[model samples]
Target: MTVRIVVDRDKCQGYGQCVFEADDLFGLDESDTCVAAAEVGEDRRADAERAADVCPMQAITVE
Candidate 1:
């Protein structure tokens, strides 16, 4: 199984909090915007959920 990660670019503020929770799943781009992987193994669901939880803008969604 795999979980899907979605980040709302308009709602994102370039904060790297998600990166701290899961570097392999999230990152900052050259423009300082939040970038994230589209999907991850079910084993990483916790990491993805953490990233979403810490998002100040609530820009991240995991499903």
Candidate 2:
């Protein structure tokens, strides 16, 4: 199954915790806002989940 990483832009505060956890999948934009890859493979499932868990605002979801 294809893994997807979802971030709630309205709820995210751009804390960078997700970026620190999964640099390959998450990042800070020019405005320092949270940005994430649209999709990931199974191999990155754990990392995606970890990123979601580390989001202080609970704005990230991996599925």
Q: After superposition, how far is residue 23 of candidate 2 from its true place, in Å?
A: 0.5
Tens digit per residue, CA lDDT, model 1, 1-63: 889999998899998999999999999989888999998899999999999999999999999
TM-score of 2: 0.93
lDDT of 2 by residue, 1-63 (tens): 779888888888989999999898999888778889988898999999998998999999888
lDDT for 62 in candidate 1 is 97
Worst 10 residues of 1 by lDDT: 31-40
**TM-score on alpha carbons, each prediction:** 0.95, 0.93
Give me the runs in candidate 2 sitting further than 4 Å from their true place.
none
Q: State each candidate's clash count.
A: 0, 0
Cα-based lDDT for every prediction? 0.93, 0.90
